[model samples]
Each structure stands twice: as C-alpha cells, then as structure tokens.
Target: MNSLQKGNGSVVRRVKLATIHLLALGVLSGVVVSLHAGEAISPRRLIEVVDISGPVVSPDSSQVAFRTEQASVARNTYDSVWYVQNTDGKTPPRRVGEGGVPLRSSAGLSLPAFAVWSPDGRWIYYRALMDGKVGVWRASADGSSAKPLTNDPADVRNFLLSADGKTLNYSVGATRDEVIAAEQSEYERGIHVDSSVPIGQGDLFRSGNVEGRLATQRLDVLGDGFARVPLLSGVPDRWKAIDLLTGKTRDLEASEVPSPQTIASALPKGESKPWRYALDTVNHRVALLTRVGDQGDLVQKPGVELSVLLGKNSPRHIECQAEPCVNKAISGVQWKPGSEEVVYTVSDPAEGMAQSIFRWNVKSGEVRLVARSAGLLNGGQRYGLEDPGCGLSSTALVCVAADANRPPRVEKIDLETGKRQVLFDPNASLAADISADMPVKLLRWKDAKGRLFTGQFFAARRTGDRPPPLFIAYYLCPGFLRSGYGGEWPLATFAEHGISALCINYGPFSFDAVERYNQGLSAVKSAVDLLASSGEIDRTRVGMGELSFGTEITMWTAFNSDLLAATSITGALLSRSMYLHGSLKGKEFISRAHKVWQLGSPDETPEQWKRIGLEFNLDKIRSPVLMQVPEQEYVWLLDSAVPLMLDHKADLYVFPQAPHFKFQPRQLLAANERNVDWFRFWLQDYEDPDPEKKSQYAVWREMKAHASNRGENPAGSRGD
Candidate 1:
C-alpha cells in the first residue's frame, strides 16, 4: 500500500490489489498492460508533441507544403521534417525530406523557411546542412529525388524565388564586427575592450570572439549567435542571384531587392505597414492594418484601423461592424484571387479574445465576417497569426488551427460557408496516447482598478471534497496548454497531480513601470480571490511561475504581498548586475532601460535601485523560490541568489548552453520535470517513488525542515 497526505492532514491509501489483478490478467493473456493509463499529459510526452508550420499552398493551388519539428531526446535537439498534402484532403500528407536551417528574426521567433516550393510546384527549395556545409537543397514534390542547389562557403540566411523560376535570389553574410573578431582571434591578437562587448560573455582567452568562429568557420549554428557585438546591427547582407539553367552565380546589388522601408514608403501618407499586408497588383490597390499612432513612436494604443489605398486616392478607412476595434494588432491579410476583396484575422476582445476572420471589398467599402471561433484560427503558440500563416486558394483557405485542447493541425476553411475540414493532424497519435478529458474553462475577471483580464482555468482531476491548491503561470495563454510563454509550468500535468492551474493573459499595461507591475500583481490577486470565493480553489495553498517580463511581475508580487506559498522563475530578474551587464551591450540598450525602467547606474540612482531591484527586496520575500535559469543568464542572479542561499529561501539550477527559450530536448525535459517535482514537494507534500529522485527529495526535505525551524508552516498548510 502507498499513502498520500492532503492539506487538511488526512491520509489516503492506495491499495495494491487493483494493480495486482491487472498484472495477473495481462500475464494470463501474455500481454503487458500499462498500470498508469489515461493519466494527464507528462513532461516527456509533452516534449514529443510535433510543432507544425508553413502550410504554404502550391502555385497550382492543388497541394500544400508544411514543416513539422519534434524533440529528439537522444539527439538533444529538434528533428525538422517536411510534408506535402493535398488541399482538398483527398490524400494523406507524405514526408518529403528532413532537416533545414530555420530562419530566426531579430525578435527571436523562428520563421518557416523549409517549405518554399518552385513555381511549377515540382520541387521544394530550402536551406539545409549538406556535407558539413549549410547550403540550399531541393527535393522533388513526389518525394522521389533530392539534390543540393548551392554549395556556398557561407550559410544562406534567406532565399526568394523569381516568377519565371529561372533564377534564385539568396543572401549570405555575417556581422561585420564578428567577422573581424574571428580574423583577429586567429592571429592570437588581444581584442580591444570597448562598449561593444557585452559583460559576462567570457574571459579574454575564451571570449565571445572565439565563439564567433562558429558563425565564421562552420556557419551551421541555428538562430542568433551568443555574441552581443552592437556593431553587427544595420549591416547589409551580401546578395547573389543564381541561374538554375546555366548553373552560374553573380553578385546582386542591394537595390535589386525591395526592402521593407522601401515598400512602406510606397503606401499612402499617414498609413504605415503592419506585420502583414495585402497587395493587389491586378486591382491596383493595397490594404494595410495600421495602428493608431505616429509613425516612429515606440508605444502605441491598442486600437487598430484598416486602411485601403486605391490608385493614389485618399486612403479610405474600413470599420468593422464589431465595435471597439481595440486590439494589439491584426494579421493574415491576403488579397482574394482576381478580386478587389481583402481578408484578415483579428481577435475580438468583446468575445473573450476570440479570433475572427473578416473580408472587405475595397471597391464597395463593405466589411463582412467569414468565421468566428473562441479557439485560434491560423494561430499557434503565440496569440496572433504568423507570417504566411494561411494560404488562400480559389475556394478555400488552408490554415493551421489549434486551441487549448487541440494541438496544431492543418485545416481547410471554405471561403463562402466558413466550414472547416481537417487536412492533416501530425500529433493525433501522441494525443491519443495521453488520453484524458481535462476540463478547460475560460475565466474573466476584473481587478480593483477596473482593468479586465482573461485566463484559462484547468480543474484538478481528483480533488475529492476539498478544494484543490492552485498554480498560476503568466503572461500569455495561447493555443496549447503545454506551458505558458516560456514553457516553464506544465498546466495539464499540474491538474493531473491534483492541483488546479490558471494561465492568465495580460491586459493593457500602464506606461509607468511601477504601475505596470502593480497592475499585474492586482490581476493575480484578483484571480486567486475569485477562485477562492467560488470554492474552486484553496486560497491558502497558491503558487506562481513566470519567465521574462512575467519574472518582473512575480518578483514584485513576492516583494509587495504575502500571496504566494511557493514560486518558480526561469531566466534572470531585474538587478544591479543585470543593469550593468545590459549597459555593456551599447548606449542603445542603456537608453532603452532608462526609457522603460528609469534605471541608471546603482551609484547614480540608488533610490530607484531600492525601488525596483530584486536584490534590494530579498528581505521581504517569504516563499521558497526555485530558479532554473539558462547558463548565459545565471550570472545576473548571483547577487540575489547568494544571499537567498544563505537563508535557504532559494535553490538555483542552471542549464548548460541554453538560451532564454530552452529548445534542447534534454534540457526542456529536465526543466519541466524539475518544476513538477519542486511544486509537488512544496505545494502537495508529495514525492515520486522513483529511486532516481531520492537525492532531489532529500535536499527538499532538508529545506522544508529548515522552514519549519524558522516558524514557517509547510506550503499548502492552513496558516503561515
């Protein structure tokens, strides 16, 4: 028999007879059955879920090419694969090729660069690793053959296909300063210490300059490099055009290709380009989703407007029938085939942030709704639709759709009737393996200041008569429930472990940094009180998790209130060390910090430091904190962690070679499992029986005893 203790100090026993009976049945039948069946999602299984991107329609609009990425634990990285499927759902999606270099933007989001097809739709061209070289490779549409198209010394960052399909335009270059640093390191010359070098990068012998060799020598490293050389910004890329028929390459001028600024300049005055725009060459009109603000301002209001410019006439604004068009942005703007109608997607705040698709006739100035769903449409982990999220055919729009309960799947939506048909589901088997009908409720609440907030409430599976403990993760809750923004807290897994989880989406923020943090704190407090009042959760047993901007809010809550029983944060908090390290990046970083936080040098603004720095507020924090940070960001936490470690109030673990967003398979699994264990021990007084976790539980046990000695009750208790 096994025993578990509830928060009320009641013991529940698990009998072994049921398990024995199942085992005997399996033995008599000569088959093995799982003892733990229909449990909530596990961290290992969640990591195996496939990430789908790029349902790019073929030129003939008959087939679509997409990419799927899944974590490979043995390889410690993601395995990228490509697939092609018919738009009409007539045939199943077939695998075309594997592996590609993903294109990452400055904002750190990975763009779909693996499914670019030729004009004839006979072959797919993408950048991949070939013979230890990063180059362009092509595969037949039928998956019968594949070959390398370019064997360049430098990796091709991005490529474009011409209309005629005779030439391929590609760009390959490195940051100017990093290239110079690589050449200098080759000669054993001492590097010049300047503001360009970010602090805590490395020592002189093995500095960031040496790491630049990865970009200069091999050029196979995915995403952005670790070096923060400020001089790298604004440097133009080297462009080249390759003739497919003649097998020749020649340098092309920068002006040969249109830039974003150049394209935006062609728009009408007082109208600026948003993330996605629609250009109708046949109708001689352009449609843009523009925000309500000046051209170059950093901060803009949430309200947005649709602007249409036809043949240089005054820009006409189209208004939606759904009033109060207050939104951060809209996306997926595409021109209807051979018509003056434009289609786009927006999240209606009045409808619990439900995503809605709308179409507007530029010639008639009329707008009409196409479809509306509380779940996301043409959206993924993030809130809005990504670039090239949906491709429009003559009669239907093929998009990637998902929600809190659904993993991303390719769907074909009829343009006329708005009926949806699933074209492909990559994670159908994985979803079936971890089958459990976890209930999800969309919760709406308002803070004391009248700011409205929305959250997804996941109820505990087996709480009995007692209200379950609640765990909260912030600040964005979109699509799937794998984790919040940073993928730190496992929401569904928490529910399976008898703890209800709340994932809160942020509302509007104030301009003042202090007020912004207070707003977040208010929202969290309101959520807890709302749940407690409704008998949905126990107010005394509450925990929180966060990353990035959410970390700032978590720290503020810990400093100002006694709400959290336990807390976990990934990445660094705001401290004097972080400010100093950021200052080393450049004046631009310093200027932005001053603009946002009003932060300066510690010596210059000691008062402000005491007001906002986590190091200064360490004396007030009462909850035990778990810090699982990336290796690159661990140094910034030293000032705060060292002091907290002395008091046994915090434990820190660093993942080696990890970025702000952990993508490595083993690292992600380790972080997710550790978080689960940490909360289970603190919030539930429970531990897994696996012997591998013996030492982990031992350390936590000591920490619990230390808390008791300090006259503090264990977490999930009735009183402090």
Candidate 2:
C-alpha cells in the first residue's frame, strides 16, 4: 500500500554501491536498501521533473512548447527532451523530441533543447545536431512535418527567430586563430615583451614575418580555446542575421579588434550607435538591451541601456532611469504579447526585495509596477519565465506567483479584475509523491541572537516504535523544488527510514559573501534550537548535511555546536586562507572567492584563517564528519581533507573528474548510498543493510567504537 513511501522501489543502478558505502551516502541509501517502483518519488526515482521550462505559449494560446530533463543511468547524468502540451490541460503532453542522438561528450545520449514556437503557431523552431553538424530545425505544429531549416557547418550555439518568421539572429563560437589572436594582441599591449621575454628571444620572434597569431588563450598547449574579453560592450561574437527565405546574412557583429586609434582616424565612421536585434519578432519591432558599461554587472542600477529599432528609422535609446523609467536593477524586459507595454522585473535580493514586476508603455513612455509579488527571496533561475509576473494571453497574464507559505506556482493574474487564479499545478505529482510518506511543514524560529529564520521541515507521517533521527541541510531553499535543476532533497528516503529533514535559505542566497555566511550560521543555530525543543528529533540521533558553501556552515556547526551526531559536507571548502592568492595556477576562481569571503590575502587574515578560514580547527569537531569532493575542485581542499580523515573522526569520498554541480547518476547514487549508511549506523546503531559489505563498515565501526570508548556523544546519548 505504501511501497514508494517506505523505499525507492527497484530500478537497477549502473554502478550499485555496497550496503556500507550506500549508508555513507546518508539520505538516499535507505531507498535502495528496499527498492521497488511506487507512486511517490524515492532516491531511485529522483530523475523525474515536475516543471517544464522554457515554455513558449503560442500566439493563439492553444499550445505550449517546453522542455524537460530526465536522469539517464546510461550517461550517468540528466538528458533533455522537448514536448508540446495543451494549455487547457485537457490533453496530456505530446513528446516532440527524443534522446538517442549520439554525441561526443560524456553527456552522451541526447538532443539539446532550444525549442520555441513560431509566431504564427504553424511550427516549432529549435536547434539540434544533424549530419554531424548542429543547425536550426523546425517541426510542424501538428507533428506531421519535421526537417532541417539551416545547414551551417560552424554550428549555431544560440539563435532566435524574427517576428515575421523570416529571419534568424544566431551566434556561433570563435575560431582557433580568432581566439588566440585576441589574447595575444591584448597581452602585448599590457606587457612589453622585450629581448628578455621568451618569445622575444626566439629566432622567429626576432623577425616580424611570423604569422599574426602564434596561438594564445593557451589553446596551442591545452587544445581548448579560451575567449578573450570583448573590447566593446553590446557587441556579439560572430553574430549574423540570416534571412530564412533568401539564405543570405548580414554580418551584425564583427569580431575583429577595434582598429588602432591611428588607423581608425584614417577610416570612415560606421553607424554611431550599433544595435543587434535581440527579439526581431513578428510582433513588428526589434528590442535590444546593451550593457551600460564594459563591467556588465547586472546587480547595479543603470546596468543596461535599452534600445528600440523601428523599421527604417534610427534606433533610439529608451531611458532606463530618467523621469518615467525604473531605477531598480532591470533584470528583464519583454514586450507584451500583441501590445506595446514592456514588462520588466527588479531582483535586488540583498535588500530583502521581492521580484517586483513593472510595465512601460512604449507610446506613452510611462513605467508602472504591475505585480509586486516576486516574494521576499527569488530563485531567479527557476521555471524560465519569459515575463515572471506577466505572460500575456491576449488580455490576461500568466504568472508564477509566490509568497512566504507557497513556492512559486503558475497562476493567471487578471489585469482587469485584479484577481489571481491558479493556472497550472506543475508539482502536483511531486507533492503527492513525497507528502504521502512524510508530513511536510514550514518552520520558523528565532535564534539566541533574536533573528527570525524560516525553513522547510519534513518528517515521517507515521513515526512508530522509536523517535526518528534528524538531518538539517540548507542553501537558498526558496519555495518549491520545482526548477528540477538539482533533484529533490532526499527527504522521502530519509523520512521513510526514520529521518527528518529541514532546509533553510541562508539569507537571500549570495555566493562567497561574508554577510551571507554569518546569516547561515545564525540560521543553523535557530534550526537546532527549534528542532531540539520540538522533541520529535531523537536527541542522540541528530545529524547534518551540506553542499557547496553550506560546508562552511557545517564546519562551524560541527566545531562550535554540540547538536549533530554526524555530518556530511561537499561542493566547497573552508581552507581558502591556507593558500596565498594566485597560488593555484589558472585558479583565479579560488583567489576571487577568498577575497569575497575575507579581506586582503591569506597572510592578512591569519586570525580569520584560524576562526573561519583554512585552519580546519579539527581538534574541536564534536560530530563525525564526511567530505565528498569532485576531482575538478581545487587542490588546496585536499590539504584540509587529509587532516580531516587521518587525525579527526572524518571520512572522504572523491569522484574522478566529476563536476561540482552534480555527480554522474552512478556516482550520485553511490554517494547517496554512502550517506544513508552513515546516518543509519551513527544515529540508530544499524549496521550495513547488505551483509556482504565489510571493509567500509569495519572502518566506520572502528571510528564509532573509538568515540564510544571515549564516553562522548555530540548530542545527548542513546541512554537518554
């Protein structure tokens, strides 16, 4: 009756981990232990998605073209497919695109999703690989005809269709010499390569007869090209506007370095305010947004300058911050369907701002706020809304509305009536699946410092003979798990096996910022106090887990607080202060992140190095720690990893060449396998579920025995 509720029903994994290794995986291992197919989502079924993104509502509003991704065990990652669905919800979604197109990358089997509906609703235009080349393709709305529209060998990386359905503005990557020459030209101007330099001393270098491009961006050595920064703003790389009817193109963005000032003064001037049409739609006008300055930071005011190009008339600058324009960061601007009102959204999370939606009348040039409910915190990347608060269907608007209690859901905000109605319940299946096994609730609490925080709480619906263990995980956890970027939290697996989960958004969700880190620590404190006082969490069995910067919080909580029995941390490290700036070669990411988290250099933040930085403070950690790292992560973290495993009561799991964002399905399942085992044994004295596994559990047993011998329990003991 409750199969999926109790376990992830059986689906054979490509690289199944042993029971002990699975347990170390923490939350997911419990599902596979007693795996089978069922209604609700389990770790085994984590591959499914509730929301379909990049939805293009057709002109008549009869159909919606969108895409979704599903995990593929064959590829060890997620692959995408496109679908068309009736907006009225009468008919089930008809799958338009399928996987099985072979590709060279590790993401082996599948097609890319660039699907969009043609303005007339007769066809759907998308980019896909065909005959060893990636090009634009189209399919009829009724699914009767499908064929290649553009055959370009260079491959279209990104493209958009014109309003008249006659033009395509596409961008392609730079070529080998193009990339190298840009890097070399920029480097020569910044650093004078005299006779002392390696190149200057070479026999060929002494002569000016060599080819203009000798290989740069390290492409000659690395075999991978790196792009040089553009010399001008609002210019696309290798941009071309093609007339689909004529098979001819006008070069809109030329990649050549601006001619030297001396050479430029001798030449004729071109158009003064060059514009690249972003959406040259059938809607009868061209819309373009250009960065204000070369810096291109979108968070600041006046970040972009908007330009409108009418038929033959000159392009005009649409004032962004003048008399009638908005001063807040304009994150987006889109022309309303069949109207002239330009809708935009403001996302300033640092100020606790919701995503306020506004509209500008192109004829009157008057800007006004239409919908001010972006929620206190916005997961800006989710759902891929063309207009967050306003998707026009003739006179009505479709929106993803949100509030403190509800995650963003599709709704129609009626402009005339000022009333809102639910449009689509994307997560209905997901909500039913997980909620069947676990009772989910929203939790709010105040820390000792008197700051209020909120988080999502989940526990088993039926807690039987023994009180359940607890695990707290967090990071920018706003509203619904609808985006389907990262799979749902392993709450179902955890709850079914007697574990509860609480995830919080650590202050507006900023990366590498000190202010957010402090807020995360405070939120963790509040979570611990609230969960402990509720008496639902087994006092001795409280564990914790974190990914990315959440590891920093894990480090602080493990060392400073005595709430957790065990913990897992990944994604990033806490030892940025251990290495000097620029020490890790080609590792400017580390250097920048370090500066954002602290001041000056590792040498300057010695005290902070010991407090929150690299020093590990391993001697003080009360909970057993587990750290899983990807191969591509920086090496300095390994320096901290050794001390954590060898000296402290911690373990490490490292995946080869795995990207930090997510693991291959095989690796991910194994990781979850290990986590479930870790929490199970530490919190409930449960051993390996599979009797065959030995070495992994043996090591953990020794760690537990060692701790037990010392008469220590991070949280209250089982004796309690």
Error of 1 at 168 (Å): 1.0
For model 2, how does the per-residue alpha-carbon lDDT over 317-408 read when each residue is reduced to its tens digit? Answer: 45545443433545565666767766666654432234665666667777665656634222213321222224456555555454432333
Candidate 2 Cα deviation (angstroms), residue 226:
13
> Which candidate number maximizes TM-score?
1
Residue 562 of model 2 has an lDDT of 74
Q: Which ten residues in a row have the lowest lDDT in candidate 1?
A: 1-10
Which candidate should be chosen as best, given lDDT against the real structure?
A: 1
TM-score of 1: 0.86
For candidate 1, lDDT tens digit of each residue in 1-720?
000000000000110110001111231121223324464477766665666776677888898887766666655655566777888787777677775533332112334444677889998887765444456777788877777777676656567777788888887665434555764674476556555343442233232211112221111112112222212322356788889999899888767863433435546766556644667665566676666654332345556676666644556555443332334356457777777677878765544456777777766667667777666676243522135547677677877776666566778888889888988766554345333567777899988878888888888865567688889986777676677667768787888788899988866644467777788899899999999999988887888987777777887888889888888988777677777766655566566566667777888878888998889989998888899886656788888988987888898888764545566667778888988988888888888999999998887777777888989886744421
Instruction: Return the clash pairs for model 1, or none.
Output: none
Write down the TM-score for model 2: 0.67
Residue 645 in model 1: shift from native, Å? 1.0
